[model samples]
Target: MTDSVFTRIVRREIPAAIVFEDEQVIAFMDAGQVNPGHVLVATKRQVETVMELAEAEAAHLFAVATRVAKVVQATFQPEGMTLLQTNKPAGWQTVPHVHVHVLPRYANDGAELVWPRKDPPLAELQALAARIVL
Candidate 1:
């Protein structure tokens, strides 16, 4: 299996501001931050998307993400928090590696994600869903 940047980071092949790490997961600061204390939590293996992760791996990643989120929340003291994970490129995923983005939100913070609402026909939606079957 080909290794992702996250995998390299986990193996110390690449540098990352690691905040937490375990056998299954690693949490680190995002090199590009959308908000203060933004953290990226990813699995050690080279899973490219959430749909590609095993159930046990998914659970472990979330558990680690929660732990890291707590630290980020405490450090930033934002109004609320947002936990985001993107899948394919169409889902706004820049990296091929699976990762969870922990974003701290503030009351007046201008950070917002806007997507044009498009309600495709039911037939098209069904066809797309069918094609995505693992």
Candidate 2:
């Protein structure tokens, strides 16, 4: 994989509001604001999606995400926080590179995530769970 916008920022090839960085991952403020303290955690490598990341690389990315969540939680003092990661265009992943969105949430803040609830039959749900190896 070639360098992504995030990879460039990690390498200091582009200017970013970088909050934290290590050899494996980089955390920075989002260029666009979903919330006041929205942050993006991205891998230093150029893997395009979470599925593309090696196991070790994925672990490193999540570790950075966890740290960024703590910082955002403490500094912003939001009512809640959301960790979001989208994979591929079908999942609303705009960037080709893998990144996680650390969003600060508050009541009446208009950040709504709606999921249609369908109570699948108990047997179906059990079958699905059984199929999941993890």
Candidate 3:
């Protein structure tokens, strides 16, 4: 597979305002600023989506996101925060590589996160749950 833009950034071939990094993950300032400190946390081992992650890699990615959210809260001091992760194209994932977004949010920031409420029938919900549940 071709190396992603993120992989280039990881290799330091391109420059980015990186926030935090470890052997397993790297948290860098997003190219576009949602707030003062919108960060994208990505794994060094590239994959297209969260489903491709091993259980431990997913856990570590979110763990890093959780920690970064706290730091963003402390540094930016926004009223609230958001942790957004997108999947395939339909899910609004612009990049092919997997990453998580941490944005510091304030009231009336003009960013909207909404999904239409789909009230599925009880039988439908039960069937979906049965398929997913271990």
Q: Could you say which candidate leads in TM-score?
A: 3
Stretches off by above 4 angstroms in model 1 are 117-134
- The lDDT per prediction is 0.88, 0.88, 0.93
Candidate 3: list runs displaced more than 4 Å. Answer: none
Tens-digit lDDT track of model 2 for 14-110: 9999898888888899998888999999887787789988899898888889888998999989999999999989888988889999999988988
Candidate 1 worst ten-residue window by lDDT: 1-10
Rank list by TM-score: 3, 2, 1
Candidate 1, residues 46-134: lDDT per residue as tens digits?
77889898899998899888888898888889889999999989999988899999989887788788989899999999999999866
- Model 3 scores worst on lDDT over the 10 consecutive residues at 125-134
RMSD of each: 3.4, 1.7, 1.1
What global local distance difference test value does model 2 have?
Answer: 0.88
